[model samples]
Target: MTIDTALPVAAVMAAVPVRDAAVAKRFYERLLGATPDDSPMPGLRQWNLGDGVLQVMVDPERAGGGLATLMLDDLAAAAEGVRVRGVSLDIAQGEVVTAVARVVDPDGNAITLVQA
Candidate 1:
């Protein structure tokens, strides 16, 4: 079997589902160490990272069902930055990546950081 297709995605905006926007925003703000760069609609908040965006949206039934991974040049520094901002995460060695750490938002959504 053969198929021809094209994915011309210019950029990506990951949507993180949450139960409470306010609470989730606060948690993400600290974890990312900045306020949201945009909010396109109610119950939604976004942060621009590099060439992409990460957004949190309110969805009670879908809360805690989101996950995103971020690759960084310095995993230790990134982990330390979040920790100092009041987000607790533990770093560990992994085969796929040099170092990795994970943190969960108040609503249970997780964001994984890895050394690239």
Candidate 2:
């Protein structure tokens, strides 16, 4: 007769729209350092981003680019890791332990990696 209020929160996926699924897939693969889960639908790709999946969907009419944010263990390290792969990154001035680095995908969507 007890409730499980102690259950931790989890993130499954963050669906993002792209102009071209292939391009998006390549972008994410390079950024995340792994291939994504292919879909039979032919217009979507899902990359496994740790506890969650990042879905790159094809939708030409999709708006609101550069609108996704992600929190990571070490933002600076994560950004540096990806930077070596030739990814253009932007970091905001703040505490090193609590900094944010924004990275843009080929589709122009921005995802922020924060240190916390």
Candidate 3:
């Protein structure tokens, strides 16, 4: 399969903004079930997810405004795992998918887990 685009695309990464790196790190650590894989630069934490990466960046101006929906094979198990790790997310039925769990990070950035 090929995608048509005006500009060529190589790799993709996502950035989630937060007010404080320390606070954000803690929340993501639990939510993701591990510490960041890399901190390539100051004020930025990166996690390699499959072929992509997710970055938690310190940007107060954009904090609480970023959103991302992650694909999950088992939303129920994943939600329970995170909950046991001390992170809480609300699970609900979705119109386009089987189910979805929504969570707001320490800085309020929205993270949704979708089961398809």
Candidate 4:
């Protein structure tokens, strides 16, 4: 039961449940402006999100059951990009002066973009 904080940890993958993997894949590609890194399994798509991996998979029972918050270098630019792709965002209040914009995927999974 001892932990080693000094050891390097492996990358983390955030999973987002979707009703239709194909639809989610297209939405995410437009939203992130990149194709999936790989599809290790059927009905599963993975994207490299800098610090971590974003996995979108089909799971009828758990569709729309996850939330991810991404920190961006420029909030305005990111918002505009998504907007151009026909994605609407809700600019909400943040804890500090940071700007936060939120959007939901086809399956209703929430993705929040933040700029500090």
Candidate 5:
């Protein structure tokens, strides 16, 4: 079969709702190695993590239990940066680009940062 299509999307945004905006902001800042650009919304923040944006919004009734795995070029560096920021590193699994490390945000959201 043959089909015609345009190129894929240029960017993506991962929106995550947190119970506390302040805590969420701090957690993401540490994970991304930088602060997120504050959104005009009263309780929303965003961080540009290269290929995609990490969005955090405040909602007292929010719940956490989602995972966002990032494909990083420099897994060691990224993991080190997170550690330097006081984030605990999990046990490493797999090998090469398949290695994975699961870390939790201040709000208790689980995120897997991998090299692939």
Candidate 6:
């Protein structure tokens, strides 16, 4: 089938599956430094990160099997923030030109924070 050229498409939220919604909510709140902006429905929590939305949803089947990457202004500062929250970041590799850090959530979901 031919695609429509007049249609408009835009990127939306990224869903990260978690075992428990409540627990994940608290973890994300601490990481983002703010409470969830909205919870559209049960088992789903969302945070507005300026350009896009990050959704933490309860999904036992796929929990701990998700991955998300966040591009930040300062990787060091962000890593420090995570450490302050009692969360350790796994520094898989660091490039002098572009700093990057990896962290796993309570449910084992991988999150890569990169300095841009």
Q: Rank the candidates by lDDT, best first.
A: 3, 1, 4, 6, 5, 2
> Quick one: RMSD of model 2?
3.1
lDDT per residue (tens digit) for residues 1-116 in model 3? 98887777676788999999999998999999989999999999999876678899999999999997788899999999999999887889999999998898988889988998
lDDT of 2 by residue, 4-56 (tens): 89867677678778887677777877787778766747787776667877778
Which predicted model would earn the best lDDT? Answer: 3
Clashing residue pairs found in predicted model 1: none
Model 4, range 8-113, lDDT digits (tens) per residue? 9677788999998779988999999889999999999999887898899889999988898788888887878888987877776688847899888988899888
Error of 6 at 71 (Å): 0.5
Model 1 misplacement above 4 A: 1-4
For model 3, the superposed segments whose C-alpha errors exceed 4 Å read 1-10
Candidate 1 C-alpha lDDT tens digits along 1-116:
87758887898888899999899989999998999999999999999998889989999999998999877899888778988998888999999899999888888888998896
Q: Which pairs clash in the backbone of model 6?
A: none
lDDT (C-alpha, whole model) for all candidates: 0.89, 0.74, 0.91, 0.86, 0.77, 0.83
- Candidate 6 or 4, higher lDDT: 4
What are the per-residue Cα lDDT tens digits for candidate 5 across 1-116? 87769877899888777888888877888877787766868888887777887778886566485567777877787788889998877647676656788887766677888877
In order of appearance, the predictions have TM-scores of 0.92, 0.77, 0.89, 0.86, 0.81, 0.83
lDDT of 1 at 45: 94
Model number with the top TM-score: 1
Candidate 5: worst 10 consecutive residues by lDDT?
59-68
Candidate 3 overall lDDT versus native: 0.91
Worst 10 residues of 2 by lDDT: 62-71
Clashes per candidate, residues 3 or more apart or on different chains: 0, 1, 0, 0, 0, 0
Lowest-lDDT window of 10 residues in candidate 1?
Answer: 1-10
Model 6 is weakest, by summed lDDT over 10 consecutive residues, at 88-97
